[model samples]
Target: MSKPIRNSTEMTDITRLEQANAMMRLVNQALARNDLAALAALGFCHPHIGELKQQGGFRSSSIAQNTRMITRLRKVGDTHAQ
Candidate 1:
């Protein structure tokens, strides 16, 4: 059997990451594209991010990665467009 989580923060992190990974898979399928930037630009992202925030979590720890994720998800057809 798995050991119990050490504390709340640890539990939250575990739960959040697990959720993020699962969500990412579904998001990938929904997007029907592997382009990371594309996924970051739509309403789908809000639901994903909002759910994580509600869980008291972040998209990821790396600021660069978060920016990239957001940039990719933008609604513009051109992934690189500002």
Candidate 2:
């Protein structure tokens, strides 16, 4: 069997996982709100989800994994037309 991970390494992994989780939450909320600007900002500077897919499952499911942000802006006329 493989040896257990070091405590510090375990903590670092935990922190990375938490950060990825938080980024996912923010990305989902932005998507739900249709706030493309916020999503774009995150997309540009978002933390690197761990290289391991399992380590960053949240990013795998959210738009944060996207390399670019593409969304149509709501025009004033369109809003008034509704």
Candidate 3:
């Protein structure tokens, strides 16, 4: 069973995960449009750019997926804390 968050750091991690997902959405959008300028502005370096291009396309992580991940992580944390 999952437990309630015991500290602020856990909440911060969730927030960071959401933020990273949002950035990924932006990156995907830029890639879709072939917007090199936008990709560069978003800080995609040469290696990452080539890799993303090779991958062709990817689905951005959905909110439901993140929620499930958070739930799973909390359950693991609860187990470890016991």
Worst 10 residues of 3 by lDDT: 56-65
- Stretches off by above 4 angstroms in model 2 are 1-6, 44-82
Estimate TM-scores for all models.
0.35, 0.46, 0.64
Report the Cα lDDT for residue 50, model 3.
80
Report lDDT per candidate.
Answer: 0.47, 0.48, 0.73
Which residue pairs clash in candidate 2? none
Number of the top-ranking candidate, with TM-score as the measure:
3
Model 1 scores a C-alpha lDDT of 0.47
Candidate 1 residues 4-78, lDDT tens each? 434454445555655566565555454444443544653446666556445444333543454445444442223
TM-score of 2: 0.46
As a TM-score, model 1 comes out at: 0.35
Candidate 2: tens digits of C-alpha lDDT, residues 1-82: 5444335544455556567667777766666675667866886333332222224334454543331211111232234335
lDDT of 3 by residue, 1-82 (tens): 8555555666577777677677778888889899888888989887888888888644544645776677776666666567
Using lDDT, rank the candidates from best to worst. Answer: 3, 2, 1
